[model samples]
Target: MALCDIGLIGLGTMGSALSLNIAEKGFDIAVWNRRTKVTHAFKAEAGELADKIIATETYEELIAALKSPRAIILMVPAGGPVDDQIAQLRPLLDPEDMIIDAGNANFHNTRTRAASGEPFIGIGVSGGEDGARHGPSIMGGGPKESWDSVAHILEAISAKYEGQPCATWMGPDGAGHFVKAVHNGIEYADMQMIAEVYGIMRDGMGMDAAAIGGVFEAWNKGPLQSYLIEISGEVAKAIDPKTGGAMLDAIVDAAGQKGTGRWTAIEAQHLAAPVPAIEAAVAARNLSSRRDARALGEELFGAAPKHLPHETLSIDTLEQALIAGKILCYAQGFVMLSAASEEFQWSLPLPAIAEVWREGCIIRSAMLNDMSEALTEDPERNLMFAPYFSDHLKKNHGALRQVVAQAALHGLAAPALLSGLSYFDTMRTARGTANMIQGQRDFFGRHSFVHIDGSEGQHGPWAD
Candidate 1:
């Protein structure tokens, strides 16, 4: 039997697509799955590419099929499954053999697993099902030396932005996964902001799904052009065949998450980074899930007020607000990434990360091209402080403020947008109301407040 260049464990949708893509690139691949039937099915469906694939029945067979200094990519579920697979593969593999975990596992776990004896690579793969079959953005994090072993294969299967591959070696021990988590967090905020804008168009302007979809289509041609906006437009226009109503209207309002967004929020809190927009998005999802509470609240406190007249809303203003909200969301995510980089001593290359996200991923946008350039120009500065984006915020924040104010007055739920506006406003303020909060804390709990001149241990007197 011919030796395979790489071995892959898992024949799920993502794994199968990725293996086909790699096989098409002319690399011999050995594949294994927990269920033997899955491997058989994959080989049967491989068609002309079957010649490049070797389907193995056991872990030992999978390891034995690979070439010297073997490499295996694991596409299992995150957390415990990843560790279990590592334990099983450890004794079968040599010290130089490499194992890459390509799931959405927590970065901390990746770090811990890498510290073990195995030559582990923690990679974050994005771009969903279609992208996996064609091209995905690949972020690899592990020992720098291990990257060279699989870099060519990764670059071959990754998406390209302006002829450049959307794959890069990020940093050692979890940096890739950390960045991927932040990407998902920003995705959550982006989705929530879009939903909020759609709500405004639906309720405030009294537009139907088709009309709202037209707005999203128009936005996709401009600065806000992105995968999310494009899909939102498609989703808005989809009609339910049974009910003959908008598909979105027929579906449940509740959104589901698989923990990446929550992980990002928790990490932000630990790092002291203000990710209000991301947190608000997560909270909004939780709130959406509490249907009984919402219904009860409506009965007790009365339903939300009727939307304002259509004349009160402007599509241009809505677009501006969305752009601003997206900026805030990305800013917060990047801030968390920066904090994590410092805490972990990863020295993450921010520009390269942004560059890889330019295409293939769910958050792929034209804005990332601008971000990549901005970071390249000033590597140390936060994105909001960049001249291009600062100027954009200066011009667009008014629209965000106006939209947020209108939403409040109309009793519309725009939590993510409102949080974005608030975060931007707070960041720009020189002297915030936090001093009063400090004073209150000092008076009640003797927590101590800092003086204006930088003196510490100052307490405020309380009136009993």
Candidate 2:
């Protein structure tokens, strides 16, 4: 077998797709799997790309098949499995050879591994199985030199937007995974907000799946144009083959998660950064899992969702409200990213991060193009404060407030949308309720509050 450009472990869906993509990009890649049969099957089914793949059954053969000072990618499950693989590879691998964890890992583990004086990097790859086979957005971290050695291949395999690859170096240590967590957090909020609107259309407006899908399709042609929106349209448009009814109606209401969004929420709280929309989305998922509890509540409360008449709210207004919610949600995500950057001293490029998310990633949207431009002008400022987005908020916020009010009046659970509106309102306020909160805290806990009159420490008047 020819000496391969890279060695990949774990011949699972993502690993197989990525290996084929590498071979398609004209790089010779060596591959292995925990199950030897999987490696053999992958090679047998590789078709023409098999010519560029050297499938090995063992770690030693995989290493031997790669070129000197080799680079190996681990596509195994995150956490313990990654550690076990690295431990297995350490004795056979040279000091200069790199171990890249291309899984959705918690960034703290990445930081520990990166700082271990080893040739290790943790990266975040998005776009799922199809994207891995074609192109996905790649976020790389660890040493610049380690990244540079693999940049050519990563860039070639990344999705492109306007001729630019959606792959980039996102600072050192766990920066890439941290950014990926935030990406997932934003994705959760985006999907939640979209689902919230879909609820409004279905339950409130009494629209069927096809009509709701049509709405999503129309939205895709405008600022809401995105992979999620486009797919939402397709999902809604799908017909159930068995009963010939709406596909969405046939499916269960529960949404499943793998915890990246939760990780983002936890990390944000750790940094004392506000990401209310993402947090609300995470909460929504948790709430959705309790089908029994919801049914019980409906039985106990004697209140079901009442329809919102179209005379009071239009689909156009709902679209505008979704637009505003998306803006607020993203602004919160970016601010959380800024907080992480400051706390970790990663110097994460917020503009470049936006550009990287412009294609391939789930959150890729037409709005991100404008966000990239805006963040380029001032990366530190809130995205809503950007000239383009600020104008958008100005025009759409009233629609958002209206939608939120309507959802409340009727019995719809639009937590993400409501959270987005609350965040937007809080951000625009000058001198707000935090002072009252501080005073209450001081009266109870004696934590002390900064006086408005420039006194260093102050206490609330508790009838003392």
Candidate 3:
């Protein structure tokens, strides 16, 4: 008897990789793709394994192959296409059938999709194709009862990082994708910061890519070690056959991003959360990818700032600089999430979220150990106020400043990471320019402002 537990729609890179992971875990899979040829090809590739994988070109056939009130995941591009597919599937699917939107769909859309009176899960699957094939970070948001129904299959497909499956039912409504979206936003900023480090090392310090990679590898052994740093070291060492040197030189400087990263920044802005790094990350990608940015700048301002060489940085100095930037990256990601959780009423658990990412997510860092310890002691403690982290940030602010200064000296952009660090520092301080900004808000909008003086200031008039 063909025993299929999960039905996968769309076998593109993500879908195909995830299918492999699920099937390898001893679960039957029913597969379908809009392009029948692709489905046929996947069927051919499955061979004897194909027996377990029932392939169908039609949604009805795919639904027919599933177990009663079946569980299905849609890996299609989110937006109108997802809605169209869901509309088609709704009639065929029973009321109790479960549908997981496993793509990078906006949580807003996830919320809307979930309102259909059926169990709809908005899942944020991070780690890309490799993560799907191996283990990736998974964030699910929906009814708890629905998660109870389908979580076993989710756990099987998720990669274990730090002894826990990198999968969590984040919260209600759109919380899962919201977390995932923000995770990608953080990822964008994190990648840019690492790339800037590479630029500084290669261009400013007169080091080769391999040399930079070597330093990154060394750093990975210490408190700064992370998946990003680990990958950075390998990327730096990757040489071009033609140049017999770093392939980074041959690769285009432009970075492409799906809308999730940009969407995160926009949502941050909407919620009045200061997600400078994520915003900077998105803007940096846009700037880097635009060949005409300089032309546009020249058109507007007549001349763009010329790129300058950075102050010479010793290996030790560069490492210190990296330490600061890396710390700032994690700090910003968490801060944004914390602020968002508050805005959305998700009441997300930070330490658990950090723990899940320890092995699987791209931003997993050695600093997570500190964060995890902090969270474990006080799971509800807002991390910004955590004493140990506060001390670490206070002690390290100088290094972060130095990194930002050095990047600026080279006329390079390090906005997101640097801004995030700045925000973290501003928030941690009991008194700072940020307080002044808050005070002004109260003066203007009649919003109450808390003073360090333990007195509430009356609103409604500035002259008073």
TM-score of each: 0.97, 0.98, 0.89
CA lDDT of 434 in candidate 1?
A: 91
Report how far residue 405 has shifted in candidate 3, in Å: 2.1
Which ten contiguous residues of candidate 2 have the minimum total lDDT?
455-464
lDDT pick, better of 2 and 3: 2
Q: Candidate 3's residue-wise lDDT over 161-219, tens digit each?
A: 54678788888878889888878887887787777777766655677777888988998
Candidate 1, residue 344: how far the Cα is off, in Å: 0.5
Per-structure clash totals for the candidates: 0, 0, 2
- In model 2, the clashing pairs are none
lDDT of 1 by residue, 212-329 (tens): 9999999999989999999999999999999999998898888999999999999999999889999999999989999999999999988774577767868999999999999889
Highest lDDT among the candidates is held by which one?
2
Whose TM-score is greatest here?
Answer: 2
Ranking by TM-score: 2, 1, 3
lDDT-best of 1 and 3 = 1
* Cα RMSD for predicted model 3: 3.3
lDDT agreement with native, every candidate = 0.91, 0.93, 0.78
Stretches of candidate 1 exceeding 4 Å from the true structure: 461-464
